[model samples]
Target: MDIMIAAALVMRPDGRTLLVRKAGTRVFQQPGGKIDAGETAEAALCRELAEETGLRVEAGRLRGLGRFRARAANEPGRQVLADLFLLHLPDGMEIVPGAEIAEARWVDPAGAGIPLAPLTGEQILPRWVAGAFAPQQAG
Candidate 1:
């Protein structure tokens, strides 16, 4: 079971979310990565965001999204189980795409590109659509 941890992160005042095109990834993805055993999802979230996007995310509500199973683009026939968190970072934090991240862009939830993780678009986007987008706009 590959324990993938991911986030749907919103940007302030623009109602956009952070999506990363990883160096070796074909699909754009939320700022996220895998979780080592013994690490809570929140810790993994903060660590992965830092490693993947160079931002220290402040943990918000842990939505406890259930596992998602799918064959990722390059991982044919192999399924990964992902636990996702919806996180928010400090206000005014500017992003610098990290080594694993080829490029980072703020994507309007209304117009997100094809998510690198299909299951991410399937599961995460609805939540982002319902509520996450506005908080950023309000800020």
Candidate 2:
């Protein structure tokens, strides 16, 4: 069975994106979680952002970036379908890793030099490079 999730491409003004590593996991990914039944994708994402990163973002702040499908990063023999969104974080916003998140990083998308989730490496980053979700380019 495929996992259904909501993910965020969190961007900072400095051309950095936020990625999170789960506890005991090495592959870094966009911070998000499984969408609950009867929950809107935006709503689930809002809840997930707060849970994983201590960011209280309203649903209105999430710009839908459409859906992407890829192999599950941590689960073998399973696929994942993600409803992705773009979230431009405010300046000086603090990110405190919470719940199962072990570390949060601000990375230059061009060369992170870290192991990334398949969804991030294959689907998201390519699109990001194409300026699909990024509304503003940092100089």
Candidate 3:
């Protein structure tokens, strides 16, 4: 079975990315959730982000990072097809874990020691580490 999800790659100024652990889940994944029927990927991501992290974001602020598929971390014999978005957040924004989120943390893309979802640990983090989606700064 394939599960469709919308995910966010939220980056900090210090080059760390945000990851969240849902309640009863050991693996941390991007802060996102399943897309509702009739919802666009960007819209779903924005809604999921706000629900999971309490961080309100405009759909326009999310840049497409491409779609990825991997074995679902929490679901047995299931694959997750994720529409990923890259978002650079302004400094000093506080994120309170909400909804299904149990905890959230900033992780160094290069050395994230905590267990991560396969989609994030394998596909997403590599792109970030290799600077495929490096943040653009206004001069």
Q: Give the C-alpha lDDT of model 1.
A: 0.65
Q: List the residue pairs that clash in candidate 2.
A: none
**Residue ranges of candidate 3 with Cα displaced over 4 Å:** 134-139
Choose 2 or 3, whichever is better by lDDT.
2
Candidate with the larger lDDT of 1 and 3: 3
Using lDDT as the measure, the top candidate is: 2
Lowest summed lDDT over 10 consecutive residues: which window, candidate 2?
A: 130-139
Q: What is the number of residue pairs that collide in model 1?
A: 2
* Model 1 error, position 45 (Å): 1.2
Model 1 residue 46 lDDT? Answer: 77
Q: Each model's TM-score?
A: 0.75, 0.94, 0.94
RMSD of each: 3.6, 2.0, 1.8
lDDT of 1 by residue, 46-105 (tens): 788878777766665444445566566446666556666555445587888876888887
lDDT of 3 by residue, 67-100 (tens): 8999999999999999988888989999999998
Per residue, candidate 2 scores C-alpha lDDT tens digits across 1-139 of 8899999999898879999999989999999999999999999999999999999999988888889999999998899999998888878999999999999999988788899999999889878888776553332
lDDT of 2 at 112: 84
